[model samples]
Target: MTPWTTLLVPDILRRICEYQRGIYEDVVPFRRFLSNGATVHGTSKQAQAFESVLSPWLALYPSISRLVASYEPIKHALACHCAYTGRAGILQHLHKRYILQSVAVNLCQMAIAGQRLDVLEYLVCIGYELPRQFESVYLSWKDQAVFDFVFEHYRPLCTTNTTIYAFASSGNEDALMRLLSYVDEAQIRLMWSVAASHGHVELARTIYTASVDISDHVYQFAGSSFFSTTFQHIKNAANVGSIDGMFWIYDIANPFFSQEDRIAVVGFCLKYAVMENLWDRVWTLLEQADGRVDYPQLLACLPYFKWPQDESNARSMLSSTPALIPMFCTSWLPTIKDQAKRRLLEEELMSMAVLYHDGDRLEAREWLGDVDEYYFNAMEWLMDEYCIDKSIAHDVFQGPLGVAAMKRAIENDHIATMRLLLKYGVQIVPEYIFRRGGIRAIKFYLDKVNPEFTIPVDLLVEMASTPTNDTVFQIVHRTWRARTSITIVHTVESQCIAQAEAHGQVNIIIYLAKSFQSVHSPSEYETFLIQHVQDFYCAFNRARHGVNQLFAIWNPVLDACFNVEFILESLDSLLALTEENLKRLVSLSFVHIPTELIVQCALTNSVLAWRVFCILLDAKIKDKSSRMELQRECLVKKYEGRKFRNVPTVDGLGF
Candidate 1:
């Protein structure tokens, strides 16, 4: 499916360009009706504008039956907008729909491809209500085995699922049952499992079946987090009074056995159930176990056995009451590989819930923080060697309250730790991290410590000069090979310009802007600047909600400088200032440029990209001759290394 990005609304402008009619006048009249939020996005404007151009496409009542036979354009549009996240959302939303339609189909296709549920639901509603005859051939639900039969021909009349993954994970019985008619069986199973694990108790109960297999495949796919939660839900069921669920668990889960894992499973089940005063049931289960149990099992059972006797019955069970011990029985705590040993240990640990210093790792984990390395070690050992898979470790490591790992790395100032995490796919600056913390740690690491991880200088210069009158301009202007990740957090381009402008770093500014232009069309940059006219102008609405005062301090080269005095004499003619100006920016790099001046040139544009980006990529600068050749193409001037200042220095002097 083509993205809405395909027919860049800019194309409409192009279409208008070929006409001699009063197009701008017509658009200008309705401009007052556009969005009031901000001009840069023009999101509201685009919506209004689209209604006129696209309304005719939606004139018919039927929507899905008219989706474009080809989806290339919508697909292309979204890709252009950097809307990959949107596409994934859409696919999960309307994947069940089938119709040889045009307008509504295009919207649905885009909605599904972009994973846009809101748009998808809206389109689907339109498709279903404004009824149309869907080509019967296209309405084949037979091939779409995932969804229920009704959804094959049309979307459901109502959309209770607001989130992309919401209905997919609804624990509500009615919702799940209703949703089954719309989505695939596998999807329904996943939704049920995910919802159940998330503590949607009623929903989980509604979905769980006596015959359903506890799938190892599902466990592996959902990861330990899901299973851990599922286990927690099972433990909580009896406490909550779900009779059907409790009986179902008892009937399905043979938590005890005589020959094998009986004690561990039975003890765990009893812990939750007995806590609620189900004494008779407990005694019945214990009697059922009979001769299969041992002294420890008997002791564990005695707690509830005497629940009829007194609360001390639980205490008696916990102490192992020396009187209950056989003459030959060992009194000391035991550890072993078999379930018998584990069952005894689990009882001991549970016993410690009221006592202390059991020397049992699980007990210690509950009572203390991670201050003890010994406990952590025991935990690691239990997890790695005991569990068939290392899933248990993942379970113990959640709740994420303290980022001990990140904190430890910061304290040690360990570059290796950072690399290791990167290798393990831990993001130091995850998007959420930046949103909450706002690069404080990153800034500290970059500015204070001379950590071994540094980015390239040209990128900095490009960013520095891009935003005029920026604080900490000196940091950006330095022509260094290594820099920390702090500077690249935002506005690498603008920062380069800010840095260059702060230090009169023209060469850097030119290179950086130009580099930004090459891969993306130059017109895009121009459009962005025009769109952001107000953001660049705080005091004056350059376009609206402009950024700073400087962009408006025009060199008279621009036809309409926003609020600042126009340097009419100094300004280059507006025509001469085309998208070609974008060729002056530079990208971030790690490689060291030989001459600081050469480095400066690299920051200006694609012309200098040869030296800096290549160096950044390969970790080595290009040969002097090749660099000089690139310098010539980018600068549009001859290079005699020393002609300007010095052969090696980018600065005006002969460093």
Candidate 2:
């Protein structure tokens, strides 16, 4: 029996309808009244907003025919999806079936989003009213073809600067130039400000070239208390890190401002560029200022450039501008409110300098204001010629500061430096060191330390799960095997797998799953498999519910399990591929599941099976793999002799 013919079976249809109703219970409250296929006028505003938000999700509906039979308010929503995905046949079916009204506005926008001119032309032919809010449409349209089509067909009324501003914000220079012909030359200030603020450098340049200067033109800055008579747009461009636009404005307005005003402008650019971490712009502004900027005030903005996140740029600042570190130490460090964080940043700065250049540089030594700071700086550079003298080594290694410096060395994976620290009797908590350090440091520590101080198994698991510590994790596994007395406890193993999956550590998941199976009987391992899968699902569902959809899409468990044969085998054994579960898997937005597996598990007791079948078909189409095609042929051969009815034929597989 064909798959689509099987969908026509009454029992299958009823089962699918029940499943869809259960899955979409949250969408029921958003329904609008439909009278003779036309939308009624008096729905609540909240319902309308819900409809807009649910439109994209509804397009992912498994059964379009079932959707038409049961849900009425969402038919137009499906229309929007059809336009977005460029499914002309589905769109034509929806239009002929519903006579969808009050839809031209969204259809036009959807066509623009999808970059579908054919859909737009179809809408225009159907006599739907042209959209009146051209600014919204123009603001979103990026394709030149769609822009020209709308421009030529609709001929937007440029009665307000809002239209010009939206067009400029889209960064379509050709379209903006065409739009400027309709706008008055005197009212281009708003357009220019929007362009510059949004980093549309070319659009801002084009607008500035065509604008007429008014003697009394006082450009009012929105959402700010100040107004400017000259070069306000230049500052706006700088605020958004628009380097090209800033230079263009500087070239035109340089002669108009006084010396102090010029310094102020460059200083403003330097401050924001540092905060935005625009290193190239920062260097350009510093060079252009020609040593006129107040170094102390500039150093105060360093905190805004986030540490570790922008550590590379901070290092670049140190290398390119030699005066930055010196000024930061003398002027900025004293004013920082959090002295502890300030000291850490100070240590990292010195270590970074030592990383890039010789640690004996005078400027690096000068930044070490205190005795402890000197010890920390020397630890990173203490090799061969830069070795510390024996006289003070004992006192330096015995203090708590030395312990902190040791931890830093371990975290940085500085094996030679770590050996030096250990040589001088620097104290370390073995468990803490093992958790953070990589393989080389861990192996060195294990080899040097007494055997009785072997790291605990729990710490081993924690080490294995730490993000970006894969090499250390491998050594951890080997360490476990080396100590034959340590038994793998069930709870500890589960925790290791869960955390590794959460962090997306693929290697750890495979190692643990396969290793556990190897050590236990099939029956015992089956129970373990069931519990592990349950824990993963519970954790995954909790994460999906608590966080935004974008966050859930990157949930590490998905990547951790991707292409792992053990996980696929576990999922297959559990028969866990139901419609709801399939949807959850698809939302990962990555790989496609096996088609044969979906046929085996997703269609169980699903009388109206086409919806679930369609999802599998969609996944297969996207898979684009000849292996998946072979699997489909296998599935067809397996089910070909069954007496299913009314199922739709798949795209590639003939019924």
Candidate 3:
């Protein structure tokens, strides 16, 4: 009917040959929406609107290609919007071919409105000068949104003060570049001043090099955020000529920088110190401050900086040295309300450091510095916070202390404190207090510290036989015997059995073996037998029906820790397996497998299983792969050792 309508609608409807529309919104006629394009490569119902406009003109050109070049951009833009923006039934007569600038401006609008960059980049290559907003798209979404808000609100092309200042305040170098193209020289100058005032030196440098009058145009807004940020930007500019420009700003507004801004200025000056490393210029700043910069930074490198005081050289000189870190230690002890209390706290800390500075074991162990309280207080001070703060003595000191305090606690037989401390890095070197208290406790850290901090094993053994305070050396003999290299297993065995008989501390053997493992691998059967032997002996050592709850509880803890897998591979484990499980060992050997299967098949007795596991582990440590795989397979198969012989079946036995 109209020139914009196409006859293809009739052809497509004829091909459909059916009308199917449903009452439900869920169902709609499909033929009306289907594309009937067959010969056309890129044209479809999606482009039907543009095609309708083209249909009337088609007889004049007689070929689609003749008119395609002029209409491509509009089609692509519409297609992109329809596909991505979820808009439908757009106008069909969009012109495709476009001048670069028009397309670029259109793309710039799209980019600022949050369109994807890939689509914008396509527009750029096809002849768009590519607006800076597209580049700022690479930044974070918040930055892009902020820039968009400035551009949308300001209307920069009209050259208003609000628009110019908004762009300057936005801190978007890309958006500022776009603004420069449309705005007047005076507007740009105001922008430069605002940027400089805001510490955006980099942005100012970009604008100045792009041929705007740097000095002449920007001076009208001399006292704004632009002024300050501009000077810093110019100073940071890579070109040597920009340096002179930055200094010129400094001459006019030297005191304009705020106190915090001055710190930034100081930092910038320090950054340039490599040029004049002799420290002559820096010394002047320090003298002006009377050597006290008062920045609260402990490592502030300016030594001459001090609180304005006359001739405190001796104190000031050493303050530059790092040993003065102790001067800050008073700041370390937890919290105090009054500044006067803080001074008192620092005094106490300096005195504490002195008391512990020498090799006083007790003082070293009783480390008074409350690191936890200090940490929490530092965190609180940062947040300008308070937490109904606990008393310094009760919250910090009265509670179990840190790692260093644990040593003193153990030395003093402070059991609960020692356990809490053991959870951390603080170690217990057995040589110090192995005789007096739980001797295994010394072995706790000894095994870990053993390789690096070597302790004499001979001394440990000797101490067991002859110790200070007439205390027996519990760990020395047991530890030395479990080692692969010690070979002195019998001596410790005899000593342990005798001690267990004499003092009835039979469980000491198992505890000793556990301690010994940290020093060396348990290689010997007899050495591993320690736990089993202790277990066997403990049953007799018990009074009657049930074990003492104290010992029973300790037994389960040991049981949970004892590795049954290792025990299953040992000779002892082999003897203890079910008779049938042991018979399967022969079959496994025929299949070129290990006999450990038989040992592992046995029902696990808590003590026996653990001890054997340790022995077998020592054997397995030498080979990790093939054996490990087989062990895994055995576990997966649940192949406990073989069953007993079935009435001497010769056929099954392969007789």
Candidate 4:
């Protein structure tokens, strides 16, 4: 091989020499050029020179092999690169040049860290070994395969406390089991604190059970303070709502917690249970505390309760601590910022007073002295429970309170209370009656209370627009009966017809259309039909009943419009209309009817076509006009083209 100096020109040599001066200044770029130089034209002398310059840079770039491989001394950099990149082939090349004990040790650590099984096997094949403490790195990496390989092939390394800590902290039970064969009791006990910190509950329990003296170990591990000790493990379980872990710690380990600490634990557990609305667990923990937790402590944690709107939870909490009611009635109720929560609390207190205290008139009176403020709220609850006395009912029905209370009663279907309020001279609010009370209540009030009262026309329209039952139609019919003005009656009638038709109410539509036609003027009826033609057709199409019923509802509008296109489009109506009605329609609107539509209808139903031919013949007989004759001829030719034979003619028609 040519010497490196002969391979390079003088300018390149000058660049290499300059590179040597600043080799330390810019190691990365210079090392890149040196690797290129060596690969292209390298000799033993240049390789030796490059080795001296590139040694310090190896620590900065362990993964870059070209920079490190340009040097021969410290060929371990090559092994390091091989191990780092999981390239075992390069390790074999370096092995031929030098014995790499340090490299082998580093390779084992890297294999464990990178989870490279091939590198580990290569090291073992080369008779390279690892120290005992290197197991800590393996344990920390939590790679069970590598740990097992190292443990089985290598002589058992003495397990250290740190290794045990890493095993427990990682929550790897299998690794800890392997270590347990060599670890002492004291070292295993030290593992508990870390296990607890990492929420390794099962591992901690295993440690406790395996101990020769668990109580001493648990006491030592739990230490003196509640906040800082391993007792936090139990508290952490409680915070996460881990019931099983908390029970495990309490039952198995039974650490020596101070009385204050015990109470703190109970409080934490209760707070979590209440926040989660786990009433069963809350009661369990409360009973376990055995009355150690006071009312004030629970009240301080009231914000944690999730269901402030639930009456059952309020009752449960109040029933748990009855003594708190007096304070809740007087102090807490007024101080609570959430009115909804305060109202629920008051309702529960009132119910309890009624159930437990024999109606406790004085306490009830004090609680309800602000009656006007909470009158509706109190009345609603009392009326629902059937516990309101006549005097309370009478007192609550004074002035506008009676109006408001009656409205609520009507909304809640409290007919008895409604009668009670009315008997006590509570006047009804007409709008409220219209809004809350349906037709039944309205009729009852109109017939029984005041016959002179009139529901607003807008209110009637609004109610008609809304979806209603059959009773609304009855109410509207009754209102039409009672009203005197024809215009208002027709307007209500027309709007109600449109609204009812929109909802596909066939019975209501029939009744309204019949009623409308009975009192309807020609112009008014025509205008109504014209305005609602689209809506009427839509209703007819979407009608749920049979063809006969829809015909009854839609016949009048069809006859008045006499629109041939519409009748042809509605195939159901075309087939269902009687021959007499079809004849009358054709006779009245023959000029407006198209020949194609007539042809289609005749092709569909030939008997109807014969009737139309008779009508056209009757028209031609009466007039004998050329246009009528031409129309007759065209329709006759179209019908005859179908080859429909044996058609009967109307006997009454003279052609």
Give the count of colliding residue pairs in each prediction. 90, 14, 31, 0
Instruction: Provide the RMSD of all predictions against the true structure, rounded to 1 decimal.
Output: 31.8, 33.1, 24.5, 25.6
- Compared with the true structure, the alpha-carbon lDDT of candidate 4 equals 0.54
lDDT of 2 by residue, 1-655 (tens): 4434333443454455567654342334433332223221122223244455434334444456575565554575567656655667677766776665643236655555556788878877877545665334333355567667767777663334555655666676676667665665434655665676668867776677765443235333242222253357666666666756666656555555566666777766677667666678777766666535766557766667664456566566655444455544443444556756665555554444323344543222222223333334334443222232443454545665557666766666566556656677776677766777757667777677555454576776666567656667766666655664645566667878887767655556656666777878877766666556644443333331222221232233454454322223233222334555555555554555665555554345444354555565565565557646655664566566787665444444442
Best by TM-score: 4
> Which ten contiguous residues of candidate 3 have the minimum total lDDT?
20-29
RMSD of 3: 24.5
TM-score of each: 0.24, 0.32, 0.25, 0.36
Pairwise TM-score winner, candidates 1 and 2: 2
Ranking by lDDT: 2, 4, 3, 1
**What is the alpha-carbon lDDT for the whole of candidate 3?**
0.40
Best by the lDDT measure: 2
Measured with C-alpha atoms, the lDDT of residue 451 in candidate 3 is 35
**Which residue pairs show backbone clashes in model 4?**
none
Report the candidate with higher lDDT, 1 versus 4: 4
lDDT of 3 by residue, 1-655 (tens): 3311222343322222233212111221222222332212223333344444334434332232222332333334334333222222221222243333432234333333343444444444445443332233222234565446435543432245554555565666776777676766556666665565555656766776673443443333334575465555545431343333343344334455655555454444432331334244444434332333333333343343332231233233322222333323323324345666655444333223212333434233342233323322332332232222323322223332343455565455554445443433445545555654444345444454353343355555445334233223444554444452556554554454445434434344344444544555545433445445444334334323222331332333333333333323344434454434433332221222235543353224455554443344334444756545544554444434656454333233221
Q: For candidate 1, what's the RMSD?
A: 31.8
